[model samples]
Target: MQEIIVSWSRRRADSPKTFTRRWKWTREDRARIEFYRTELAGCISSATFDAMLEGVNSESLLPFIFCYTVRLKDLDLGFVEAGLVARSWFCLGEGFENLRRVLGPGPRDEGFKYIEDEVEGEDTGYNDPDTEPDDIYVQEQFLTKQMPAGAEEEGALWFNVNIGAPGNYLPGLRGVIRLQSRSTIYQFPLTALSGWSAKYIAPLLFLPNLQELEVEGHATIGGLKDQFYYPLSIPLQLYKGLKSKVKRLSLVDGRMRVDDYDALAELTGNLEYLQIYHTYRYEELSPQEYASIASFFRKNNRSTLSLEEICINDIPGTDMVDVN
Candidate 1:
């Protein structure tokens, strides 16, 4: 198994004590590992975690995994989830996507069972398009506030274009890739992209040197346009010039619809590692769909879509299985 680097955070410095108080673990279990929230100048902000990622100098740093809690069903929970992705971190909500919205309605201090109940509820408000925020808007905001005009090319400011907010934040990118979450449900009407000007389009035009892209939320086949190139849903337009440059692609709380696979196969010619979560809603994929996708890759032998390893739990595959 690949060794993973685990990072944690708590609301306060004494949170370790709180964790201890909440759980009654065996002495053997307690002695096996070290778990503590990061300490950042008396606080651990999303910015703090960003700094940690930026300072690293490894071509293959183990992915940073986050373990935290938030209000269920609450908008803040969704926001925090989205924010984490924009900052280039990996998160697997303990209860999966359902945990977010459920916690939204309940108090944050509620018991574990209540939290579990929130996780079990059928509707966690993730797939709702109206609740999803815009990543460009958030990216724009981060740059205008922190970076100066001449410093953009100098790499002084960093923003993940896939985040919620305004702006592209790309011109100011300082060698950092921020990951962020997406709304569970969204509608990116590509047909609506006929009227936007370059000024509006410029920020979203990111660099071709990015290393990884961790996208969360509902990565439906047609929902990305609302946040990128709104009113127009031109596939591969968001990636534009950088399509072949991406090395790793991680999809969370998303689905790989038939059309989406075709589009992605077309854009990512050099893609190296592809990870999809909660694929097919735990239902088996149709044999036809699986074969079509597999055939697409076989035809494009040079494409990066040839995954080094595939990890799936309940999804189905074609009757013919040949990885080579």
Candidate 2:
């Protein structure tokens, strides 16, 4: 966190309040993990684990299999719960969109909207009679902010054109593939393994030169727009589309699940090597936590067969200590 504070502002890195706040959050995270570890230890044997999954009553399929928690809705439905905050760097020509279902769209492309267009008889002022059909435009001034009110969804930023009168229509988005490709995420630890990685990973998968992906930390949120894109959602497509081009994947302190490995099994089939290193001490983790890690790999056959080297608690996939 000293590095994080320093990076926030080199001069202000020494501030006591920032450190205090981070320390506070870190303590909370540690408490949360401890509670989760207790929950995991009480779970029934791995044999009956799937039976428990069937009993979850929530309609939303995601039960979030945490680095500490053991649960998943299904592997085939492609809901292998988001694992952690991921930090990845992509090399260009940085796009590899060969799949039948492509990334919806970005700032410069026309795309989906959260709300449907007006019915045939109804009128929405967004449609301007004078604008050319091919040349799309919207209220640019309205879009310069974080997000224009109603634009929510995967393709919120996607639009074909940027020309539009203020208040006439909403035109642009805050974050985009073009901007993201150059800037990149994972620069900061907190964001890389956590918030809104799918937005960036979508563009990275489109890159032709893409190969390796390294996930650091027991990340929480997976998809930004929908919360199931990384680890499982996009990687599922990577196995089919990227073929042998994308191979090497390293989980530093991964607390992955069967569903996760099941989704990643296809890609792991081509994996040739495994390297493990302890970024932090293993004793900090309880026996149950170690069991969680073992259970993750044990669940998937394809993933188990693919690894060349692995050790229990030898690598730093969970970096809570450093962050805290």
Candidate 3:
């Protein structure tokens, strides 16, 4: 089968032309067509996903748009150029909605079981008395044989089974791709994204397991002052919503009012680590900026926060001058 990313892009080809289209079809599609003309219907991956995803991390799915979704435990848009990050998040937010329509809303119950037991040639139990033999043949061929590539575009479905539950029925960890449940995502760190990227933060609620979040200065909730960006109440609501389980929060570069911390302090119940990071130029920081940054740590007594350690610009490997 084609890599899911390439297949995903190709799937969008028929979608009403937008920007004349940047992403489309795939190498595999053409490769399949060539093979068919040359009499070799298709090829196969000798290497299996079971071998590949043994210890997959955020880096494993790099450059794949799927990496940006809930499958990734940590959502770090800071790596991309700030301009492109907006598009990345927007596409991701939209992708989730599209997938939700297929997978259905609510939590994804399918466990991400990368490791699978050997079940080759076992009776899959998919061949129920009610199931037609033709349906059974399709299921068996999909798991056993290599079909032609462009065949899918021609309305040829190699494998049609229940989306979530593969079980021993689907039969191999070799080419398995599991869509992660809502509980898979935990850490979401959003840098101060400009323009529309901040608006897409509302989708974070989709990941019910998100715990650690890093909020940027410009992306802070609400516009209590001029220095901060315009009303960012949408993301603020995502972070501070009653259902949120955000534990470790790092506040970076917010030049807002002293009272903003009061709201943030109450966002999480057992906020283990609250770190304040000044991401911009340290020397040029204004007096008012310093107050906005400092006041959060100072006035936390009133909030129901069970903070363990409060870190303020605790950069590693930096020398400190003694003031004694």
Candidate 4:
């Protein structure tokens, strides 16, 4: 599933323009079109995008736009795969920005550039060695610099230019594009983003109106420790920095410690619903952690306080509330 960011001022999901679609046709196909259209549209509109998706039957139409609600203003779906039903659902939105960063173009060399390694695929290791191509390719890469552009009301807000590679210099390539002004979601694969530190992830905090943030990957929550040390702390800080007005937040196969939960509780005081999944045993907290958790709930309790659902994948016991 993907994360969506919507504005607080945006119309409620129940509104017609925000969730419905209309198309006209002649009497011949009107009954069939209207029937399927109504049924498909209602299925999408009835629940939040993250809810379990109903099967899309229209293979003839552009599956992307056909399966999703076109009325949403802006959304941010993370680590989206190619050609899946959900991926098509994302393409329906106003924008679909890709955020996977690639190594910049290789270096510029006036002299003859030599190819040392064999190409990974195919019988021939060489790429027409005689023909001089337009671009140079670099192999070894280091993080030399990070240039952050100011938040623009339109166009891409952040872009990274990678400069060097192993053998040759290629033209720098730009990655991590953000089209913030448009009411659309950004989508990319989780594996595409292999090594991201707080520095790379921190600026997302500036997007105050972000309605939802979703990350998808196969790495189980317990495996997060293998990816980065102190994994939960930094993410917790970013969550805290997020504007409290955000209604929905999701982390998939990402580590969440008890303190992280406390941090989320602290930041999203107005949150109506919250969920966590694919994590380790959510054992009852030790006495100290329990106290801190109690403090968190007390401080962030909503007036309606409709639902507070904490789901841990590997926990052993029944639900227990620690008011101590």
TM-score of each: 0.35, 0.28, 0.34, 0.37
Instruction: Write candidate 1's Cα lDDT for 25-89 as tens digits.
Output: 23333232212224321222344233222221111111121112111111111222222221111
Which runs in model 2 stand beyond 4 Å of their true positions? 1-206, 218-244, 253-258, 275-307, 315-324
Ranking by TM-score: 4, 1, 3, 2
Candidate topping TM-score = 4
lDDT of 1 at 53: 27
CA RMSD per model (angstroms): 16.8, 23.0, 18.5, 19.2
RMSD of 1: 16.8
User: Global lDDT for candidate 4?
Assistant: 0.30
* lDDT tens digits, residue span 1-324, model 4: 132332323222123233211111234343454465456553222221111111111112322232343333344332222222222222333211110011111123222222344231112222242332333321111101111112110111111111112221111111212212121222222222112222222233233434544442311122223332334355445345443544444434433346655654655554444444442333324545544554454457455223334333322112434542
* CA lDDT, candidate 1, residue 305: 52
The 10-residue segment of model 2 with minimum total lDDT is 91-100
How much lDDT does each candidate structure score? 0.31, 0.27, 0.30, 0.30
Candidate 3 at 53: error in angstroms? 28
Question: Per-residue error at 301 for model 1, in Å?
Answer: 6.4
TM-score of candidate 4 to 2 decimals:
0.37
